[model samples]
Target: MTLFWAGAYALTRVAVDKGNPDMGLPVAWVLPGRLTIGAAVLWVLMLARGQKLPPLRDRKRWVAIIGMGLAGSVFPFFLITTAQETVNSSLAA
Candidate 1:
């Protein structure tokens, strides 16, 4: 997890760097791409292990899942990507 996060930070920095427009990618593209790919990979792994998703009808479970996703994944990704525009990746990490 540490290594994964470190790499992500570095990649985010690269993606947001204005000095390297050729290499830099838009935040709009990078964030969604990262999230989608990560989610898909995890979903595949879970399916391979026969893990079941929580029932969508469970309100509490749905709330918890949404909260965790926003807090743990989405918020941080947005914050980091935005910050990387002004801060160095090494410092952001």
Candidate 2:
């Protein structure tokens, strides 16, 4: 997890740096693509391990899951991506 987290910042920096007038790749596109790919990979791994999806009918569970996703995943990614626009990736990390 630590290594993956570090690598994410480094790779995000690379992506941002590579963006220019010609390429015009925004952080908006990059961040969601990264998240989607990560989620897909995790879903595949869970399936490979024979993991079952939890019941979505449970409202409280859904709330907690959403909260965690926003707090743990989405928020941090947005913050980092926004910061990386000005801050050095190494410093951001």
Candidate 3:
């Protein structure tokens, strides 16, 4: 999780830097690509280590994942990445 978070931070930093402050590029393209790449890497790591994720058998857990993915991951990632284009890392953080 620590490493993944670090990767996320680095990714956002790079994305903001590359696109510049105006953010004229497509965030729809940007956000999903970053997420897909991260997800693929995580999936590969799990497979390589013979690790299994928890089954989404419970409604609460399912809700939690969805909520967190949207609220915590996607939303904040977009907001911070976009904001970082105009703001410093300290201010964004």
lDDT of 1 by residue, 1-93 (tens): 899979988888877774675677878888888999999999999999999899889999999999999999899888888778778888888
Question: Highest TM-score among the candidates is held by which one?
Answer: 1
lDDT of 3 by residue, 1-93 (tens): 777666665656666674454654455667888889879998999999999877878888888888989997899878877776666655665
Distance from true location, Cα of 21 in model 2, Å:
6.7
Q: Any runs in candidate 2 off by more than 4 Å, and if so which?
A: 1-3, 18-24
For candidate 3, give the lDDT: 0.73
Worst window of 10 by summed lDDT in candidate 3: 18-27
Worst 10 residues of 2 by lDDT: 16-25
lDDT for residue 4 in candidate 1, whole number 0-100: 91
The TM-score that candidate 3 achieves is 0.61
TM-score of each: 0.84, 0.83, 0.61
Cand. 1 Cα-lDDT: 0.85
Candidate 2 or 1, higher lDDT: 1
Ranking by TM-score: 1, 2, 3
